[model samples]
Target chain A: MNKKEQRDHWLARPATVKRIWRVFVALLALTVLAQLAVSIKGYFGLDGWLGFGAAFGFLSCLVMVLFAKGLGYLLKRREDYYGGKEEPADDV
Target chain B: MMFEPIPPALALLLGGALIGILRGHARSAIVLLAPLATLWLVWQVPDGVALDIKFLDYRIEPLEGSPVRRLFATAFALMALVGGLFAYRQAKWHELAAAHIYAAGAIGVCFAGDLITLFIFWELMALFSTVVVWCGGGPAARAAGIRYVIMHLLGGVILKVGIEGIAVHTGSIDVQPMLASNFDAAMILIGILINAAAPPVSAWLSDSYPESSPTGSVFLSAFTTKTAVLALILLFPGEPLLIGIGLFMVMYGIIYALLENNIRRILAFSIVNQVGFMVCAVGIGTEMAINGAAAHAFAHIIYKALLFMSAGVVVYRTGLNRCSDVGGLFRTMPLTAICGIVGALAISGFPLTSGFTTKTLISQAAANEAMVLVYFLLAAASAGVFLHAGIKFPWFVFFQRDSGLRPKDAPWNMAAAMLVFAFLCVLLGVAPELLYRFLPYPVDYEAYAPDKVLFYLQLLLFSGLAFFLFLPLMRRTRTISLDADWLWRVLLSGVARGAYGALGWIGARLAKALMRIGNRLRAVAARHMSTSPDGRRSGVFARAWPIGTTALWIAILLTSYVFVYYL
Candidate 1:
């Protein structure tokens, strides 16, 4: 909302956000590359392949999100689907 | 011995009673002291049937101790202590009391050596948990509590029927492992599955748990499902059906949580998913699998509660439950955010967290059995867990688009509680034996092998990648995703209303017909009996034709009868 507030907030800066993403991507790359140093024996034959964890994990999550989105078509309802007024947390 | 063997659950039960009667520092002391006392008592239980009673010609083992029993009891007691610390400053006195009572029920269920004893404590859990849900204190909470109680009570009745059937057939009620090979065992499995938050009935956990008060949910998440996992391990180990059911729950929790908008509900669904891993392990039924199940249950209780605590703090501060309503909270609430991230990491089974060491055991069990499909599915589910709970929760609630709402962080007690659990999550992760030794079986498994660590790190980090990559698909909306609860909440209710209306309509027509028939009969009788002798259509009986004339008719009839008798 103000220049001082913007400066104080680290995430508010586009440059800082870009740097964080760079680190995250680098971390992802390192994990994938570490497989070259350490051979992971898999219980199933297919899982032992290079980058299998990354491929499988990424694909599984992708499929699951898609599956959930499809399910949302059939099941999603408005927040007031139960017809009661929503209340704030009881602590308040 | 310095002390007589007592049921460890009593400490919390007594504390619950005292909290209701006491006030101020005394109440606070009891709130904090009871769970610690229970934890001390839990360790005191020897490895056997420590106490028993006879009822209806049956021996009931009210207190039994085993490694598994003690482990579950320890977790319950610990949860009560930490949860009390989290809530005492903010929650209503009765809610705290009900929560303690609820924790007592879970602890009670842990040490029960016989089916009857287990059932008693099982019902105790069901009863007081409803009170905790009601502690949420709203129309939604009230309605959710009613639904929750009805489901649990139904499960309890089914379990009772099965217990009775088993007792009648075998002439014993000992808590022994059995398969669902018969009607009795099937009933028992179904009953326990309901509590395990297994499919069809699993919706109740997601439905009611999030409706509880922020503090109330922290307690609610720990006991009921984990205790059910304990019960399943004790009674129905090696049931193959559980493998399929557990897998379903694993996926079910992930999908629903993915679609969920409310931060608390997402965590609630994750409970089902995590419990799924335990259930699946129990079905594997090896010593390794059983150990894995027990250890996972212990780890799950800590991290899941931590997640709920962090979410509770957000809700407490911002008064917002939906993820869409608030973001960028990591700025103001660094402790809460870091604790939540730790919880998220632990839940994801990241290499350095509690979930990693414990959950890997279940996957290893599947691998040991050469159940290739089960192992792969479990691995994928682990990834799914990270996607839904591990990343989705913190992302939406803490780090997504700035909602410009800056709320203060958790209060001292809450933060302290989170810190303790967060520390335990890492502590167990770094040193698996701290938990592994307490497993019912010996631990030969090593969680920190180089290959295993790399494998999990890759899987989880990649899942994290998928999360950010598919962020648009996972955006929060002001909506809820329906589950099996819809059957009773909508379909069954609609059917019930229709049946009631039909019955009312049928009864009304039947009453009208009966009245018409009665009127016809009355008309015929009046026409025959009320006509005068002169044909003047006078209703003599109805109008009360002179008392004298009536007496004269009576006399004539008596005279005629006398003449006939003489004849």
Candidate 2:
């Protein structure tokens, strides 16, 4: 690794990166587990179940990501798809 | 004699005009001071049609004040101030002028007491925002500006027709609460929806906004759709059709945003999604829903501008916009990164952020109405928001695999503007009552209930988990996602070319047939008129055989003349 990048930032450390990810995952677990203790009063019949927020939030996002990936196959095109010049004459 | 109050929008308009003429710090000073002056003037307006004048035969109220109107005007004016602060150092002088005039148009819409005044201000906005888009200064910007103006002008024309219809049919030009049940009202609703960036016609927002200059976009994001939300709250509250339309917009924004690659275009799509929440609340049309829509509109202007400002800085420094081209910027651009994350969290409705306080109100309103399906879909869309905008934006643009870019942080004025908005995002969240006091209705909802916070935390954090889990799928491709604009940009143009070609072929055949028929007719005329004894071509009167015939004709004419004289 280059010396400049080595001293660039603490976030560049592999150990520090791993530690941050660990803490983030732990927080995610805590939010889900807290739901067991506090009953979520959902207006809809199914949403009041335990971990409903976590499950619904995760699953819906999963669905959206999958849908988007599929849509990209259909709708996504090269940057110059509309025949606009590949390089903009000026930065905006 | 008492002096009449001046219209507040006039302050910004005149400031814009002066900015065009002045140079250096004087122009910058006007940019900073005009919005503050307008803000003061906005407060001076008393409720209920503060200024009325007669135009032609009709009485028009040019300045009206109500809590909601004042609230929207305050937000717009503040946006002009902060936006001017951000752009003064970098944007072209004409860009700054156009943006201020655009701001004036939005503020004008807020205080318009009658439909005619509203329509006039609406067209004014259409005129100047196009100038802002053109200020991007490229062929792409030029083309996109034309398309954007066409869309807005089309909407303006539709709105004008509807207003004229209402005036002629109902004998009134007053702005009042109404449903879109009749033809005129439906036209008005459609017109406003186009501005709101509603689906099918909504491609204009995403297509044009990202093409604008970095500073221009920060201004662009704040005004157009929010004003439409204000107009909706004022005119079409409680319209049932809005519910379905709003739901479609919410989902449509999520899908398009998820697939988007450009940093600004992603945010642009999310604007549609965010406005969807407000449109849905207006559809609900309860007091709480109206308040929610208004509050969300205000909060949205701040946070969305914050996000755009950060994106603008990234673009300004690196001269790159695609997520694929830049990353690991947080190492050098710490302030910009942090503020961007703050804006992202606020948009995701994270606890202790402005988005949570405002967005939850819309959800709660739907629940209050027992709209089970809507509430659930909104919940899903909320998670979807975090996925596309909250995590994806920051993850791709700042923290993804390094593309070896180490650009400097935001310039001082830009940083200051970001700080101001970032502070407001938190301030409104921590003490939402500061915003709530100004709502059109009395406040009743509690945003920070323990249970509500817990539920939102769980929802958003888990969505964060999904973002990581599905990170591989979102690998930025140097590409763009096609939108409804493709229909006009590609399909429509192709159809026009084909029609022209077909017409040319038919025209060639028609010309050939006409030439043949002309020749035939000329030949027949020559046979009758010019055949001589020698079978030579000659005029009938010039032929030698005509001498005897002419004498006989003279004799016959003399005889007829004599007979007529006898009679």
Instruction: Give the alpha carbon lDDT tens digit for every residue of B447-474 in model 1.
Output: 9889889988889999999999999998
Model 1 alpha-carbon drift over 4 Å, by segment: A1-5, A89-92, B518-567
The whole-model lDDT of each prediction reads 0.92, 0.91
The positional error of residue B22 in candidate 1, measured at the CA in angstroms, is 1.1
lDDT of 2 by residue, A22-50 (tens): 99999988887887787778777677777
Which has the greatest lDDT? 1
Look at candidate 2 and give me any clashing residue pairs.
none
For all the models shown, what interface RMSD does each have? 1.4, 1.5
lDDT of 2 by residue, B220-320 (tens): 99999999999999999999888888999999999999888889999999999999999999999999989999999999999999999999999999988
